[model samples]
Target chain A: MKRYAPYIIVVLLALLPFSGLSTYMMHIIILMIMWSVIGMAWNLLGGYCGQVSFGHAAFFGVGAYTAGILYFKLGISAWWGIPLSVVVLALEALVIGFICLRLRGPFFALATLAMGEVLRVTAENLRDFTQGTLGILIKERTWVEKTWYYYIILAIAVLTYIVVKKIIESKLGYYFVAIREDQDAAESLGINTTLYKTIALVISAVLTGLAGAFYTNYMGYIDPEVVFALHDISIITIMIVMVGGVATYWGPVVGAGIMVVLAEWIRSLPRIGTAHQTLFGVLLILIIIFLPNGVVGDFSKIKRALGFGRKV
Target chain B: MTPLLEIKRVSRFFGGLAAVMDVSFNVNKGEIVGLIGPNGAGKTTLFNVINGFYKPSRGDILFKGQRISGLKPHRICRLGIARTFQVVKPLQRMTVLDNVVASAFLRSDSKREAVKKAEEILEFTGLSSEKDKISKGLPLGMRKRLEIARALATEPELLLLDESFAGLNPTELVQSIEVIKKIKERGITILIIEHHMKVIMSISDRVVVLNYGEKIAEGTPEEVSRDPLVIEAYLGEAPAA
Candidate 1:
């Protein structure tokens, strides 16, 4: 049953569009899948590698801009941005890793956060290049129907899941966990921690970049503020993984679903729409207090608390 | 015969203080050489220098006649030099078998081969029963054994055991001594830093004594034990005569 769970989920999701869902419902699903992609990317570096990054927005924004600039400057199809963004983002990741991977723990986190903010400010100031916060407009999207976008993101999510799963089961995965558990021991055992950490960072950054490129092609418009927002992109990515599960395979998927749905639900409330972030803040605090390891990580504890399991 | 490992006038300094000062030693292949010193006498520091954790401030280290003074730790490990921590560093959340397998992966590219090597090492270290247990949950004795299991999995030509018997009970100590003997039988040279005098004297083919970051004596274990300078360093200057 456990082995078949992923297949079951893929089958179910593949058939969901045939259920005559509203356009808005499809949008929510697409958003959920997209965020899950980002969350999984973050999980590879922050979860397995133990290098928490607060600057994923840097990669995200760079990816979006790669697509946006190609379309805006070259008059080319923005779909080209999807493949081209990988090159752009990998270079960006290399630079980021060189500078930030030298620092550990909160220092690394802060360095990434600072990098995101720097990119945002640079995007805003570079008027001719990034349109200086005037943002970029695709003018025409590839599809008028939401169905194609949903399917594209679904396919990407599946690919990301498979890639991450494979990596976590391989020797590289063990090396990552060893580094996370103890860097010194990992080094002594002949694992080059720096090289491995950079590999995790590059893979993570490229995946997140793909999601960002997809966002620009789908959303039709993007601004520096929206793409590079620290709290919105970077922190939310971390929160999605944290609220779901730190190191578990299914944590980001569950977390993204909950966060996206809760966000939409809160926004739909007329009187409390503005308080959605406050609700998220409260939820984060509660999760940290009661489930420091995140929901998936603390699943057994949660089950016991809810009185569903046998007494120990 | 050339030594399997050689330390030539090695010194490691932190700012103005030298932790290991011009300490020279050699371990011939297939011998157990014990390094005994009082607390803070820089025995572990010397081990650190030998294993490429620290660059010697003023000297050179050679493994099998090749200079390896400034190489990185992993590179050194890959060059057939492996060392355990004085404070055992197990990959805490990983199972004992997995921890050993990780080290075994250094020499074996195939995961199946690595697992086979890890299992063999586990059995040899007497940790087969606890193979599935989390490393952090193991008792001190077992954790120490896990450390040896992990180091051996690397298939080192020279294994440096840093205080492997530091916190063992009498039975565990005897078991560890036997294990070390078996490791020696496998024809791997060992340079061990041990605080227990009796254990060192019994197992070491030769002993080197350090006092305040300098070598005080080097001879057969019996000869070093009877050396007056070694006694003075451990017992403190005979009440200033």
Candidate 2:
């Protein structure tokens, strides 16, 4: 019964789009779903592998640009580009992981940041192939129903959740957390820490790339900064996990919802200067200094407090 | 009865100073060998070299009749080696059960099965009462026990423990000695680095004394304790501690 609770909750959330929200609201719902999925991917590598990447924007850009170029050159549909973008970005992520994944903490963050900068600059420079920052203009799909987008995003988000959840629950995920907790100790446990870390980064990069592809087509354009902006590049997602709880399974969801909803409330209004960021900062500080366990973290604590998981 | 583990001419040079130079020893299966040395005697560094944590500047390490030198730590572990840290490295964010289960994942695939085994291990090690407790919140004694549980979870044939009795109370130390003895009864060879002379003398089948990274003497605990070099090496001139 206890083991089935997470599955039951996942099923309920999976049924949300089918529950008939309005089209505009469903679009926002889909957007949140997409962010949540991407954020969760970031959580796998950033939060799980303990290699915080401040430059997930690079992988996101690689994915969007892969599909964008294929559409412009080979006349391929975004659907076809999904797999292609994933493959391309996954390979690129592998290369980046090899070079950059060896670093940790602030150094790793800096490496990723530099990689993101280089990718953004290259996208701006590659004029003929990428339309040189004017961005790739994608045609609206035949099925432009906002409801379709919602369902599509919802389906993928559910899948992303399951895969990440599985890996985290499997021999692999245990290794990731072991590495996250202590690399030396993980190695002693027969965990190939470096190899496992890179594998997590690759899986995470591919998923985020897929999100980028979906996002470029969903929004109908692909400028380097807009699609691959650090704002969109799981940075918000990392913040979400940190606020929600960095390494927990449900942390990403809570973190994403908290920030995305708060940002939505602000973006719905007239222009506000750093109002969203200021709120995120203040909220983050409070969470960091006080509610560090995050929302669901409290649930675990509550369960323990209630003597559910305790031995006594 | 043969040497199940051997370090032959192992030397580790950092720049020019040899932290561990040409040190060598042997341990038979199921024996508890205590490695005792003074401060800066490179006890932990020698353990690192044998367990594949640090590649020696020049030497070869053998286990069960096969050369195990220059292997990555994980591969060395896969070949039936496991160790604990001087500073216990429990996954603090994880529960006590999780720390055990993570190491158990080395041998099992099913979470349910692995977790069940982990629970039993904790029970066996007298930590089932703290199963769901946050690892970091555990007292020092419990944390040391967590480290032992993790090492045991690997199903190791040879276990290397660093400073397991460093910060334990008398009761805890006695409890841990019994646990280590029970672990040995299960057929695992044990190598421990300890400063607790009484614990070493009480538990070790044989003892090796090191000074300035050199093997000063090797024999039964009482024999090594009486040697001039072992005395001068570890105890200043007094021979009694």
Candidate 3:
């Protein structure tokens, strides 16, 4: 009976929008899912391989703008654009990851951060292609489209989950863990740490890129400043993964959901608009210090509470 | 039989310091060789050059008749050479099984096959029951066993082990010695850097002694044990034994 618990929660969550929920609540739920997808993408490299990157905002923005450009300038649909964005993001990540992944420890993080800065500056300066940060406004919804946005994001989220799950269970995942554990030791054992690290970053970039494309169109606009903000760096992504539990498959999901919901909750308070980020930061620090392994490390406890897995 | 590994005057210089200078040795197929040295004698550095962790500043390293002096560590590993770190760097966050499976990934195509083989190897190294346990949380003896399991998973023809018997009780040491004996029985050549004279003397077919980055003695275990140079290198005087 408890084996069906995860499915039941999923079903309940799935049916939430159809339960006559307010539009605002639907927006929050959609936002939570989007952050969850983003957090998970970040975790593939940051969590599994222990390569922390603080430059996901650049990939996210690149994906969003790629789709936006194809749709507005080339007269392509988001259906085409999203895949293209992923391809572009994957290729770019391949190049950047190749260079950045060679650097170990904090150097890897620094290199990626520099790469993100380069992207952000290029997007803002390349006025012809990116509109110099003023951004692009979609003339109309790309699909039948408001309702489809829900299904579309959900599908991408499902795809993200499965892809991440497969990686976690594969030899690639094992190699990633080895790389994370001791890169020198892993290489000595014939595991190519560089190759695996680059692959992890590319896979992460592709999924995050796709999610970015979805996000832009769903909001019906694309702007570099909003998309490429350093605030979106991997630290926030790290927060999600760490607060949930790094290297655990569903860790990012739980962390991202809670973070997004908490952020939204803070925004709901009167006169809390400017104070929200500070609150989030403070809460993040507290959590990191106290719950470093994360809130979900107690899998048995969670399973018992949710009525899944096995006897607690 | 061809030598499994050959080091011909391979030297590594760190600035003005020669960590391993003019080091030449041959490890024969299915042979267990002992590398004995005093503290900071560059035995580990010589092993590093052989395993491709550090490229030799001069001379050739031939593995199975192919030069591999400056090859990437992973490529050398693929050429059937694997090593354990002296520091015992177990992938901290990964489980014991995952650590072994990661090495198996080097030679295996499928995850299922790698995992199955890793399970057998884990058992071979006496880590089967601790398969689900995280490696970081394991005892030092278990970590050593896990390291052995990982090295075996790569299907290496030769293993360059750095201090395999460092932190172990007598019981654990006996078990590890038997495990190493069993490994040699499977026809894998072993080059071990160990401070435990009794273990190395008993298990090694040949022994090489090092002092101040240079080889000072090479002979059969009995000859090496009685060599005045080997005793002087380790103790500054001849051993009464």
Candidate 4:
């Protein structure tokens, strides 16, 4: 039963769009899955590889721009951005990794945080190229109904989940965890820490870029602030992983569900709608203090606390 | 015949201070060479130079006649040199088996093969019983042995042990010596830096002694122990008449 949980969950998720959810609910679900994709990507680099990056928005923005530019400048389908972003993000991740991976711990985090702001500023200044603050708006969306969009994002989510699982189970995953454990020890054991770190960065950035590309196609509009957002994209990506569980497989998914659902539900509440951010901040603080490993990561502890499981 | 490892006048400087100065030595194939020195005598620094952790200020380290002085630690590791740190570094959160399997990845890309190699190393290191336990929870003696087990899993031709036997109890010490001998019997060359005199003297084929960042004596264990300079290095000069 435990082993088949993921398959069961995926099947349930696939059937959700057919159950006649309101368009708003479908939108929220789509956002949940999208955040999960980004969360998983961040987990790969930060949780497992031990290279915490706060500049994922750079890759996200670049991905959104790739699709946006395709439609706006080249007269191509914005969907092409999905495949193109992989190549674009790989190159970007390599360059970013080369600069940031030389620093460790908080320094690496700060470097990545700066990278997002740097890209946002560059995009704003490159008026002819990125249209400055004017932002790209897709005049015609690929689909009018939410069903097709739902299935497409779900498919991408499934693929992302599988790829993350496969990578984490293989020898590459061991090298990642080894590097995370102790870089010097990893190098002494014949693991090329730098090469593996770059690999993690590229894979992570590409996955996040996929989500960004999908976001442009789905939402149909993106600007430097919306796409390369520090608080909205990068920080939320970290929160999703941290709240879900740092390194556990299912942590990000559960975290994304909580984050998306809570934000939407809180905003819909009549009296407390305006205080949602404050409430959300307090909730996050409570979670971090009590369940530091996130939901899935600390499930057993929760069960035991609720008197449903055996004590250690 | 070319030695398995040749350290040629290696010197490592931190600013003006020479941590290891003008050090030279050679370890023949299939020999266990002990590197001994007083507390601040640059033994670990010399090991660092040989393993490529620290670049030599003015010399070369030739492994199988290939100069490896400026190579990255991982590159040197792939060239068949594996080392244990003076402070044990276990992949703390991982199980003991996984820890060794990570090292075994050096020789095998297949997970099954790496796991098999790790299992064999764990058995050889006498840690099979504790293989499933998280390494961070392990006692110091077990962690020390796991360090050697991890290094062995890399399938290294030259193994550098930096104080691996430092914190072991009497029974663990005997077991460690037995494991080291068995490793030698398998034809791997060893260069160990150990302060445990009894363990080093008993197992080492030759002993090199250092004092004040310089080699003061090099010979058989018996010869090195009897040398005036080595004695003076260990136990300061007798009061002047």
Please, what are the lDDT tens digits per residue for candidate 1 over residues B120-209?
Answer: 999999999999999989999999989999999999999999999998999999999999999999999999999999999999999999
TM-score of the A chain in candidate 1: the value is 0.97
Report the C-alpha lDDT of model 1 over A21-47, residue by residue, as the tens digit: 999999999999999999999999999
Model 4 misplaced stretches (Cα beyond 4 Å) = A269-281
As for candidate 2, its clashing pairs are none
Question: What DockQ values do the models have?
Answer: 0.84, 0.68, 0.87, 0.90
> Listing candidates in order, what is each one's chain A TM-score?
0.97, 0.89, 0.91, 0.96
Docking class of 2: medium
Put down candidate 3 lDDT per residue, B206-229, tens digits, no spaces. Answer: 999989999889999999888888
Q: Write the per-residue lDDT of candidate 4 for residues B64-119, one digit (tens) a residue.
A: 99999999999999999999999999999899999999999888969999999999
User: Model 3 residue A233 lDDT?
Assistant: 45
Minimal lDDT window, size 10, model 4 chain A: A275-284
lDDT of 4 by residue, A1-312 (tens): 999988999899888877989998899889999999999999999999999989899999999999999998998999999999999999999999999998998999999999999999998889888888999899998888998888888898899899989998899899999999999999899988999999999999999999999999999999999999998789888888878899999889889999888888888899998887788678779889999999888899899999999868
Q: What share of the true interface contacts does candidate 1 keep?
A: 0.75
Candidate 3 Cα misplacement greater than 4 A, ranges: A1-10, A143-145, A299-312, B237-241
Which prediction has more favorable DockQ, 2 or 3? 3
lDDT against the true structure, per candidate, is 0.93, 0.84, 0.84, 0.92
**What does the interface RMSD come to for each candidate?**
0.7, 0.9, 0.9, 0.6
Docking class of 1: high
- For model 3 the TM-score comes to 0.94
- Over 4 Å off in model 1, which ranges? none
